[model samples]
Target: MAYWLFKTEPDTFSIDTLRLQKVACWEGVRNYQARNMLRDEIKLGDEVLIYHSSCKKIGVAGIARVVKEAYPDHFQFDPDSPYFDIKADPSNPRWMMVDIEFVRKFERIVTLAELKAIPDLENMPLVKRGNRLSVMPVSEDEWQTILHQE
Candidate 1:
């Protein structure tokens, strides 16, 4: 299975929230590049690293598994929803989402600084300069290297 890293603001939806809820609908992705990955690449059973971004303790907080594959992001169709897209049509969805189930929470965060310090992870998108896609693919080698830090 492929590996992925999904970034989220802790204040918005943290690893703790995922741990408590057990499963979460990973939605509201507005970027077309990220949306394409969600719709075309990510699949059920793929592992994920829940990375905390836009927060004080920014890092990879835990692991999750894609329990459900891509489906139309319903929020894009709800006028009252913040994620609503004026141009999105129900007949042809523009955004997609996946369902991820909490797998394990790391004992301690694998900090961004720590990740950047590792030579093996230098090629990882998350560690690259200015690479800010909410969803990013992680190579199997990168995945294992990061996990080893836990």
Candidate 2:
């Protein structure tokens, strides 16, 4: 299966929260590029690196496994929801989500600062200038290298 990196703000939904819940519906993705990756690329049984972004010590905090394939994001249909889209209809969704099961938290965070220092990750999108896709593909080698940092 393919490897992926999913970014979340630790204060909002940290790896610790995922560990407690065991599984969660990864929702609220409004960016079309990130939405496409959720709808088209991510699949059941795929491995994911839980990247903690927009918080102190931003980094890869843990691992997760996609337990369910892509499905329409219900939040898009709810008027009260922040993720709601007024133009999105029940019959034709404008967003999607996936269920990911908690796998394991790393012994220590693989900090972005450290990631940038590694030659093996030079080509990684995470280390690329201005790259901010919330969900992005990870090469097998890159996945292994990041896990190794723990």
Candidate 3:
């Protein structure tokens, strides 16, 4: 199965929140490229690195699995929702989301600073300067390397 990394603001939805909910709809992705990855690449059973971004100590916090395929993000249709998109139509949605189930939280946070220092992770998108994709593909080697750090 394909591997991926999905970033969320810890204050918004942390690994603790995922453990409590068990499963969550990964929505509110506004980037076209990120949306396409969810719509076309991710599938049920795929593993994902749950990352905490836009916060102190940004890095991979836990593991998750894709529990549901791509579907229209309901928030995009709600006028009151912060993620609502006026251009999105129910019949032909402009944004898509997936369901992710909590797997396990890392014993220690693999901080972005730590990742940046690792030569093996040098090519990782997360380590790249100014890279900002919320959802990104991860190679098997990259996944293994990061998990091994735990």
TM-scores, in order shown? 0.98, 0.97, 0.97
Best by TM-score: 1
Task: State the weakest 10-residue window (summed lDDT) of model 3.
Answer: 123-132
How does residue 111 of candidate 2 score in lDDT?
95
Give the alpha carbon lDDT tens digit for every residue of 73-131 in model 2: 99999889988899898888989999999999999998999999999999999999999
Candidate 1 residue pairs in backbone clash: none
Give me the runs in candidate 1 sitting further than 4 Å from their true place: none
Return the top candidate by lDDT: 1
Residue 126 C-alpha lDDT in model 1: 90
List ranges where model 2 is wrong by over 4 Å. Answer: none
* Displacement of the residue 93 alpha carbon in candidate 2, Å: 0.3
lDDT of 3 by residue, 2-72 (tens): 99999999999999899999999999999999999999999999999999988887899999999999999
Best of the two (2, 3) by lDDT: 2
Candidate 1 lDDT tens digits, 28-109: 9999999999999999999999999988889999999999999999999999999999999999999999999999999999
Residue 73 in model 3: lDDT? 93
Give the clash count for each candidate.
0, 0, 0
lDDT of 1 at 120: 96
